[model samples]
Target: MTDWKKIRAEFPALENWIFLNTATFGQLPKRATEAVACHFARRDRYACSDFMGWFEDADSVRATIARLIHAAADDIAFIPNACTGLSLMMGGMDWKPGDRIVTLEDEFPNHYYYPGYLAAQGVEFIETPFERFYDAINQRTRLVALSMVNYSTGFRPPLEEISGFLRERGVMLYLDGTQGLGALQLDISAIRPAMLSVDGYKWLLAPTGGGFIYVDSELRRHLRPNIIGWRSHRDWRNHENLHHGTPEFGTEAEKYEGGMLSFGPIYGMAASVEMMLEIGPEVIDERVMQLAGSVRDILRRAGGVLRADSDSLYISPVVTARFEEKDAGVLAHELKSRKVLVAARHGNLRVSPHFYNDETDLERFEAALKQVL
Candidate 1:
């Protein structure tokens, strides 16, 4: 007995709105907010004192994230957002002229800009449908960038199948796990991607501006980040030493930590991720899929068209639907007027349910949508 109702009580916003837009932003849980407050309180009291404590908290959170993904703590690094995480990872790569990067069509734009930027440097960027990604990869492909789950259509790709195929050819896999990581069950260790980036705001139930990046250990050994600072050195504190020669950087992904981190957001994400871990990953997945299934049933009854096949092998916590004659943006606004929260992505009404959401919320959404329709 997980006491899901009690768990749902942790989020007070649900009392105000039927929140089904975990894709856009997950409501911050009380525990995470408290942790953030605690960090600010500490910072207010000690302006610059106990600097190592912040780093320790970051390391602790890093270890927690590693545990969540079944990776070594050394492989994880806290970042400002997934955008920077992707930019930092790919931007630092040793891309050569004529190298091709394969990404999905209609990604959330973070996946587009970097490869597009690299186009000026003679790097070829290819965008393909998720279903045809396997067919699009040719010999020139060096890295495959994609989201584990499509934010627009709640389209969870055949990640493992694709990863296995890429693994056979030694093509690096880069994943933006923002929409899939926390709400869904994924074994990062098993997938063994070269890089994975995630933001904590959505699905993870954390505050904004905090996220983590995972770089493969073997990749870390060979790749040198484009950006490095004082913190990049293993003995950064030894600057006051009388004589220091060549600086030795950390071999792990922590080397990319670069500089100071926002302790508040780190703590906030830690608290939220801990909550998910406490609830159990498999348990959360089951609850989310069950709710999403009910949402599909409701939309079907309301004469809304599902964006993807409900019976598809790949599905996610996100479900998108649209009335035949209704515009997704207008429908979203209509629902919001009634205190129902959903998102419009790629001209579809996207509703993402989490473990804490229950039947009451779903029923409210069904009634509101039916009345609107």
Candidate 2:
């Protein structure tokens, strides 16, 4: 059984407030914080020591992330944020005048605007209503990019079906998984998207600027390195060969990694990933879904209107509902005043519960809602 109480103890922030906003930013576990501090201390010990060990650390972190997504280690790369990954994907692809890309309207701006940036290369962007997003893809479409979960409403998309449909037409699929990665169990092997990017700050419970990108092995060759840095070469550490000819391009997804690695945040992310794996993704998924479902039930019984699909259990731990006669922003403030933390987005109260949150947390949240409503 998953011991959520033990897990909660690992996150010091949870002890103070009911942090139901894992969708916005997750609370870093104490272990990750300590790991970051340790890395900083190590750096202080040897200011100019060889950085090869840090590269190895980055490799190991990518390997762990590969296991989490069920992808080959060589197929993943470290990026500072999800936008960089999306930009690399969009910029690497060849585009022609009138070429169309399809995506949803309410997507996070980073995911939305990168395709529009591609539009400046003479590509056209088409936004379909999220409900009918699949219907908009056609022969003229070159790529389909979307968030796996709506950040605001917590709507989980049908990733498998969309991937299948896009694959049949030879259109690439890019998924932004920021809202769903750690909170949901997603098998990227089954989804088979061309590229999937996730930032660790949100559901992954790591510090900001720690994120990863996944590219299918076959698609790796099709992408050119968007940013050039000395570290992107295959033999980047050989400082003795300063006058050597241009270094050979990296053989795998390492080509996407540009510039010196950020060892501190990367180490922190590695610790967070290890902790999540120790708890088991399946167990975390089950516990979070159960708590979110219970919270949804409580809200519905209190006459709140649910904006997400009521029957779908695959939704993210984030749940949202609208009160009939109250301002969602005001209700959110009221909940916060009672030591409950939730976000108000798009006229609904966004309640996101993580693994550390327990039934008692839900009860406290419900009692606060009762008072607010």
Model 2, CA-based lDDT = 0.83
Best by lDDT: 1
lDDT to native, each model: 0.86, 0.83
Structure candidate 2, residue pairs in collision? none
What tens digits encode model 2's per-residue C-alpha lDDT throughout 165-245? 889999999999888899888889999999999888988988887888898887887778778787677777675663256
Residue 137, candidate 1: how far off, in angstroms? 1.2
Inter-residue clash pairs, candidate 1: none
